[model samples]
Target chain A: MNLIEILSYGFIQRALLAGTLIAVLCSVLGVFLVLRRLSLIGDGLAHVTFGSTAIALALQLYSAASLLVSLPVVLLASLGILKLTEKARLNGDAAIGIVSAVGISIGIMLASVGGGYNVDLLSYLFGNILSISYEEVIIAAGLFCVVMVLLWLFFHDLLAISFNEELARVSGVRTNLISAVLVMLTALSVVLAMKLVGIMLISSLLILPAVSALQLARSFRACIVLAALQGGCSVVAGIFVSFLTNLPTSAMIVMINLLFFCCSCGVRRLITIRNIG
Target chain B: MPVEIVATERLACGYREGYVLEDISFTVNAGDYVGIVGPNGSGKSTLVQALLGLVPISSGSARLFGSRCDNFSQWGRIGYLPQSLHLLNPIFPATVAETVALGLLSLKRFPRRLTRQDRETVETTLDVLGVYDIRSKLIGELSGGQQQRVLLARALVNDPELLILDEPTAALDPETRERFYHMIADVNRSRGVTVLLVTHDTGVIGQHASKMLYLDKRMLFYGGFDDFCHSPEMSSLFGEHSQHLMCHRH
Candidate 1:
């Protein structure tokens, strides 16, 4: 087969398209999540997403249906945690930590019991980028479009709310609605990205690019653009390295992101030193 | 009644254990500089949140702009600068202008981003605070004083009818504190913005505020600044060195 045919094979094409869209959606959400110190929340959402996937498998449903059904369920679950932390005496981080553990444990237990032994649990946990189908890509692409449109529409409000939620509310931004929208968007992105980035390494995709962009972006508009570029680069570069070296795409992507993170820090430090000198 | 910007009645709040503050009633009127003063752990912060409905009010009610405090759909018209903001995301790459612009983000719905009006307001507020030149500077690069101003200017960017600042000058040098105090006074006088600030700076309060709320277990004293400073209990609370605080304002 020629290069185009090899790349156009159902699974490979699926992986590429899904990865590109998922990367875009996630990196956008990542901007706020990392800035707001909710990187752990992104990680936690992955566990919750896995629980949904397992439930979908057990129920014999389409994976997309599973994601769709579970996205809100998991978001509601986390929102429940947030409200509890506010009303109860529990520490917020500790609460989310407990929820994450419970979710993954339940997912594994359910999957094992359901006897879907043919599907590699480990592969899904890390990411099954090569296993994606065109159907998955189409679904991911649609969600990415929705998120992008919404983000563009509320860019100013989202930026402000992310920076200072309470102040944003006081200044006339409907911060509560904005926050709920953010959480919902994050959940949706996590679901779409789970197949490409996989559950384990996905949070890296959700965070590193944002940090990298934050170091270099001189403006909010610049930050979003750079974050998108970094995300696209990481995914593309990771997939290429994986194909050439016969490594896992997900692992390669995360390593690439870490490399970007290091370079960003080094460059920023050098700039600071130069200015000082 | 030109419409009180903030009002609370018998508002009670504390941990699940019990109430640390209770039965406090007050109203913040236009151009009123109400300084909330109290010792540490007296639920000052809790009261601030309760007023905003961030923290649940265990008893009674609180209102902002004639609506219940917790409903944030109409929150675009209020201005709140929480204390302990120093414990916030300090290293996030936010410019002075971008940070302040956050305050006005809710005025418009999605699709249209920060408009010329929003940027103009942000720029004017920065200029008002004398930080216009540093508008593009990152928040992390600024000194403690400048960062504090950045946060304050963010609170002021919306030009809300009422500006509620929790310990607005708590983390600045005395000189910087004076500048901020004057800035606040200017906003109140020039723009007709109502002001309610929680502070431990009785000296600054004496110079600018029209009212004071002294709290320990509850609203121990809530009235004029003059009456608050002269009362023997209030006077004794400051100790023998209280006279120094009286002469602090330049």
Candidate 2:
């Protein structure tokens, strides 16, 4: 079908609207997470959502109602990750690993014991973005506004803490509160985004765009802007490409992000060579 | 009488394992340049961290500007440069000017937006530190000395009343280190800013500091430079020859 033909479908329209909003949210948050060395947090929280989704399905709550079960679980799991890093003196990766391992295992055990829910669970594992509902679109838009507004309100404070937590604290930025806000927002994003990108590939959405921006951007503000642009563009392009090629929409989005990252690296190298010669 | 900027009375602080600093008592008045000298792992950093409320105090009391250390909210009066410059990520995308502007954040309330006047303040501080030309350069791209100066400019941008530097010159070359010391001494002398500098370079810091606080987990010595030079206890602690080398250089 032609481009106009593809846009006519309601499912395609919902997918584009929801996917763009969530992609922007993940990409913007990814900049801070990458700088703070907590990039895996997206993946970790995605796994927690997996376990929580299993519980939700076992209870016969599907689609948007699953959020009623998954939201608080994933939020607490994010706080648990933070507490482990703080009190247990574990590095961020180790803390994430422990939480991620427990989450996936709990999901596996639930899927086995609960029985007859494997088909529904598989969709969450790999995602089906082209089938997004209108309610999920509104949910995505609401989450985008909440994350972006809080991010804008606390922009300088977030920048300060991401640069150096102790320095931020000394500057009276309330580092602990800012850090909690960041992770909790990520948890919210993860719960909302699992439907868009799936649990297995969610981290790529959170990491790839931000790393690409870091390669080419000169200032922090530029980095954030570049990441958001790449994220939103990738989702729209991936949706159109998936329609034309009959490929999976979620995986296509991730591949486009990787392509953008490679192009950014190439451009950065060319700039360095030009500066040198 | 001069106003007290910092005071610790029998202050004790430590981690989960054990106390690193105990029975530490001192009072720093306005414009006093106190050099905190000690051996490696002598809790020099801990003592300062305790006073700044970065670490919890186990017992006793520490105060800044007459308020309890933990409860002190007037961070605009204090500027601190931590010892771990190596902790800064090499790819951090902040410009020197942006980094210096962070120093003004303590004085701002929530939704802290940098005003045009804040930009001017950052510019003046950068010029004072001789880093104005590189204000637009990325912080990680600067050389070690330039990075140190940029961080120092960040510390001084707000024009704080009390400046606390923990081993600020640990990464500079001998010539660069000498220039940095002179720069800090100038800040103390010209601006009348109280300084609490932590360093292991006992000999070099003695020349600039008005008083010496020699610590080895506990207070080994605290007095005027002249008193520190002649004290029998310090002589015993450092040995006569070593004490003379540290004190006579002034």
Most accurate candidate by lDDT: 2
Question: What is the TM-score of each predicted model, taking all chains together?
Answer: 0.88, 0.97
lDDT of 2 by residue, B100-204 (tens): 999999999999999999999999999999999999888888988999999999999989999999998888898998999999999999999999999878766
Report the Cα lDDT for residue A185, model 2.
Answer: 93
**TM-score of chain B as predicted in candidate 2:** 0.97
Clashing pairs in 2: none
Tens digits of per-residue lDDT for model 2 on A97-175? Answer: 9999999998999999988998898799988898888888888898889889999999999999999988888898888
Give the C-alpha miss distance for residue B105 in model 1, angstroms.
2.9
Compared with the true structure, what per-residue lDDT tens digits does model 1 show for residues A113-224? Answer: 9876427455568887887776777888888889988887777777777776766555566666776678778888887778787889878999999999888877766777
Interface C-alpha RMSD per candidate, 1 decimal:
2.6, 0.9
Candidate 1 lDDT, B52-123, residue by residue in tens: 766777778888877887774565666777764453576677788888887775465555477777788888
Which portions of model 1 miss their true places by more than 4 Å?
A1-12, A61-84, A87-89, A172-177, B1-3, B65-77, B109-112, B229-250
- Angstrom error at residue B217, model 2: 0.8
- Cα RMSDs, all models: 3.3, 1.4
lDDT of each: 0.77, 0.92
